[model samples]
Target: MSPTTTFQDLQAAFPHWTIWRSSADRLWATRNQRLTDAQLSHGLSHTIDADDADQLVAQLRNQEKLATGLLPQ
Candidate 1:
């Protein structure tokens, strides 16, 4: 299992996005519901052994870059 990313770390890394901790004690990041599928698919919304929030955010940013041709896949 990977290390857990604190809500504070994710908030600091992504202040523009909405960061929250669920009653289940999971940290979550939401950007107008855009990353919902990807977050869930990657288990970012869950508390158990979730991928590092910073890494997850980086992945999302990289995906955006790739989609926009700003970065090569």
Candidate 2:
């Protein structure tokens, strides 16, 4: 079995973000909408990349927390 989540699975799980894999095999995600200034100040970004889908998911979850003020900026 594949160790990483499929692109379709990630997209389905995170409808707010666009997910894809790079030519170099990195997993990448970008928000569908721009982040607010407050979110930017909190270190949120419009795009994120990871070595694998699992890592990308973790980063996305952290981004969600930051965007929602669940975690300290």
Candidate 3:
């Protein structure tokens, strides 16, 4: 069975894929709309870029700040 996946896991898995921290529990997959299959594949190998990763982290932080909320997204 696939191991239980967390956003962190997904971030690690797809270095090349543009992952948005959709929720603390889930990952959002995005690719530049113009990217072709080959390009997407190439990108997916890298994982989230610094800016995106930071953004995701920030989102998570914000959620954390909203003490009433605990889950991601």
Candidate 4:
């Protein structure tokens, strides 16, 4: 499958985030919900960006870990 299709799949899998590619071809995902100060203190953010789909997915997964308390902030 093409990268665009993979990205769409990622977007579907991560409904809480809005995933897209920039004009410069960078991958980005923005959380649907705003982050509180505590969450920010925990190293969570409202947005993430990567050079490619795989990196973006990895970052998204890390964000999930942070959200679920699986990883130290």
Question: lDDT per residue, candidate 4, 1-73, as tens digits?
Answer: 2546586698887888998889988988999888888888998879999987778888988889889962233
Candidate 1 at residue 45, lDDT? 34
Q: How many pairs of residues collide in model 2?
A: 0
The CA lDDT of each predicted structure is 0.48, 0.80, 0.42, 0.82
Q: Can you write out model 2's per-residue Cα lDDT over 3-37, one digit (the tens) per residue?
A: 55577888898888998878998888988887778
**Per-residue lDDT tens digits of candidate 1, residues 1-73?**
1366566666576554566656765445554334346445544332222245555666555534433532122
Q: Model 3, range 1-73, lDDT digits (tens) per residue?
A: 1356455665575343356544454444543234445544443222333334445555434323442332222
* For model 4, the run of ten residues with the poorest summed lDDT: 64-73
| TM-scores, one per candidate | 0.36, 0.82, 0.29, 0.84
lDDT-based ranking, best first?
A: 4, 2, 1, 3
Superposed Cα deviation of residue 7, candidate 2 (Å): 1.0
lDDT of the structure predicted as candidate 3: 0.42
The 10-residue segment of model 1 with minimum total lDDT is: 42-51
Candidate 1 displacement at residue 7 in angstroms: 2.9
Per-residue lDDT of 50 in model 2: 93
